[model samples]
Target: MHFDFTDLRLFVHIAEAGNLTQGAAQTFLSAPAASARIRALEAGLEAQLLYRGNKGVSLTQSGETFLRHARIILRQIDYLRDDFTGSDSDTSGHVRIFANTTAITEFMPEVLAKFLASRPGVTIDIQERLTQDIVRAIRDGTADLGIVSGDVDQTGLEAIRFSTDRLLLAVPEKHALAERKSVGFADTLAFEHIGLHDGSTLLAFLRGLMEKNGYDRALRVKLRSFEAMCRMIEAGVGIGIIPESAARRHTKTMRIALVSIDDSWALRERYVLVRSLAALPGAGRALVDELVQNAAGGRK
Candidate 1:
């Protein structure tokens, strides 16, 4: 049986919008045209696809199953179109990347800029998420690539080294902890702390450590970005725990001191993860190759 791509696309839109009129408008089809197409599709499949209610429309059980397959088919068609028409010198496609805060703050900007500069036809959609969320998105095929903390569970994903950076105790230049070469987690409890926003991966990890060691201390302030956190530390608002890469850059002009953490968790290793390197689309594979090559060359 032949299924029209237009019908499949319309079905997906309606399923997502939950309103036939809105979906039809979004797809640029009149209400009657949209209804006829959906009915035709149902006739071809010999299954009820939608349940109409006073409020809106919803997918039937069969519709849910077909929606998943329809999305896959559309994605494959996009890949095929790009592969056949795009040239090696002008490879064109879209890559969806999900990354953690550490990777976003410490890496990715230069690498992505370089990749985009070379591939003018390629586009990237990036989302910032925690490591575990990035892993989940990769497993679900919602993202083509992921950069995540290496400590997270990556049981089914293939990962390559992306970057290496570590967390450090950041303090004001004249703070009491500034003189110490290394300090334990417990020792830092005496001072007010600057921290990332609640629910951040780093903040969660630090909280876990505090709970494990039975240390309780409230944050003096919570900020969103590493730059803001470092600035706060420089202003002596409070000491903070930040990535060494970020701290190193800020310390050039900011009056901040980076003290070593005696904890093993301070040493961070990040990796680029994907469902499978071989399964990635051509553009994604190219970008991944560039990232891996850049990282390897950096080590050398």
Candidate 2:
């Protein structure tokens, strides 16, 4: 019932680090001291906050719920500090963002650069995740904001249209599928495919599609970026699926052919999600504004 500032700070550190020893070191407390503090906190709240494991620690459902409130409390404390200090020159806070690969790769660089330039004291931590994962991170309060593909559910979150891009199948100029104007995803599965790395949202989505069709996608080659995938396809390593914007750019330079994906899901849109606009920290709300404005301008 009566946890102090130190307790909240320590809890935040531990949740972020997901390692007891490391979190303790960050707080400049020994492991034993940190563990005792956490125990006291749990006892006071009558709820277990962490699931300690061999690999690392993770939040329980209650822990996740508590973390959301903890972050809001911490942000409020920061606001109080800024108010008393009268430090208008530097408006500083941390905003954590989780976004899908498409949004990260295709949309965010310029927008983030603009936001960071305007608020020099603000810092952002960005993670690339799949759409569903982004939603979960936002829902769990692990992230301040999320940018996700619109095809995913957004039942409980406030979402705004962010951007739109489509997926295209890229193949070697001489590949059998190259002559086709468009093809189903299943039609391309027989050929060895090039793909982005395993954790990429695009790759995960494709894998899910293959799974739904009762087959495994054979990713014979995996590359780190769209350009790399294009080069692999050019060399006949394998065909690949890539964002149409990237495919159009790469096709001009490489001896590759792009065929429209004959699937409804290929044409994708991105959405920026937040638990509540009013609840977001100053910097996070600013970023949301920038993303929404940019998307609107693009539409015009």
Candidate 3:
């Protein structure tokens, strides 16, 4: 219960890096030293934090909860440092955004690049999560803002239109459904599916879609990226649901067909969801401006 900032930060780095040696190196400690420190920390907390594996470590359920609070505390410290040390004209602060998979994979990289170039003291952290979770995190002060999709209920939060998102079924060229121009989400559910990993936001959304339609799906295999999903589909494993942008991009080279998902929820306008625009820090507001301005400039 009496953990110091160093141990908390060490845990964050370890959880993010998924490797003890790499995380230790970030904190300028050796592997053995980091291991001892982690053991001591765990002993003090009386809770296991990480699940060790042959390839790397993953967060236990306790670790996930611990990491969330650790991040909030660490980020608040950074914000406090910036507030007192930063100049009035300088936009210097930390902005953490929780977004869905489409926003993370398709839109954020270039915006982040441009945002970072002019602001020397601004830092950003982006995580993928379900839109419902994103809204809760924003309300609870765990996240500065969020980018969400679909017709999700945002009764309490401010929603700004930033971009559009659509999900398409990626089927192999010779598959029975590929010849069809469009297919309903329910129709696709009966077939085995290839999907992103279990924790991916897109996979979670697809699962929710299935549940909403009162269908149970079997994901034949799970991979890390859209391309991998396309590859699996091409190899006749199963069809996959991927972002329209990704489907178009992958279909040009891969032997896959993009079939529209004929569901209202499949076609969605992405929104920047926040508690209040006026309450955001300068850096956070700047990021919001960046997103909407990009959309205005036809950069969705």
Candidate 4:
């Protein structure tokens, strides 16, 4: 005989509470109804599953074995309902987005504001993470979408071209490098470089570039975020190579200068919109459309 989900749920609940009265209270059923369910489930399987006692209920050896499979089946059904049922309702739901520090601080504000204005019912949770970590978050089902600076090598994710981000050499205004309108790659490398922390796409790209130019062995101090690097540069720690978007704010608010790299090796990295090829919720799809539209407009 096959067991229905109702039976499995009743079995698990009764096993947990150890008493039909409490289990019935939890399921909003009377004790009689709950006891009848337990009996029916045991009889259908042609095995004794429970032992009625003066104090509470206990699972028989057969019940103990069946409980394992029953729990697994019930959990899967719950996940199916969670993924499909909420999709049909209002497009109002939560979207978890992961973005690198640069995109979150600079490129994402305007686009997110516009999206939120259009979908007032949808809530968004944004996390500032490194590019590699952002990809991992999507792969692990923690985030629905991601905006990253470099290529993510993970399979099962589709990355769409969003916008081109120009890299800039950010220096303090009083620094000697600020006198130059543009700096070359070799010149930037000559300074005490304040490197971005590991796991960042920017850091990875920079390391690759340095390697291509036969400067792979060079070492530098590491910092966490571009914002923190900017403060350190202002404090005369070391010059940093940061995204143009992040550099623009420092140029305006602080005693900092943004200089483009004049090397022919300069590359315009594309900011990409990443989504899992698997199922996505309504709010996630809406946000993706908004991102694509915004990207077409150059993310102005």
Estimate candidate 3's alpha-carbon lDDT, on a 0 to 1 scale: 0.84
Candidate with the larger TM-score of 2 and 4: 2
Candidate 2: regions farther than 4 A off: 28-32, 39-91, 296-300
- lDDT per residue as tens, model 2, 1-300: 788877787888899899989988888899999999999889988999999999989999989888778876776676566557764232467788988776777668878887788788898889898878788877766687888774777888888777787888999999999999999988888888778898998888888887887666467988788889999999999988898878888889999999999998988777788878776666777788888887778631
Cα displacement (Å) at residue 262, model 3: 2.2
lDDT of 1 by residue, 37-127 (tens): 9988899899999999999999999998887677667766776776676532336777888887776666678788888897888888787
User: Model 2 Cα displacement at 265 (Å)?
Assistant: 1.1
Q: Residues 104-191, candidate 3: write the lDDT tens digits.
A: 8877998889888999888788998877789888776679888888877888888888878878889989999989989998898778
Give me the runs in candidate 4 sitting further than 4 Å from their true place: 1-90, 118-120, 154-156, 195-201, 204-225, 262-266, 271-278, 297-300
Which stretches of candidate 3 lie above 4 Å from their native place?
A: 1-11, 14-67, 88-91, 153-156, 211-217
Q: How does candidate 4 fare on TM-score? A: 0.60
Q: Which residue pairs show collisions in model 3?
A: none
Candidate number of the best TM-score: 2
TM-score of each: 0.75, 0.80, 0.77, 0.60
**Clash pairs for candidate 2:** none
RMSD over all Cα atoms, model 3: 3.7
Candidate numbers, best TM-score first, in rank order? 2, 3, 1, 4
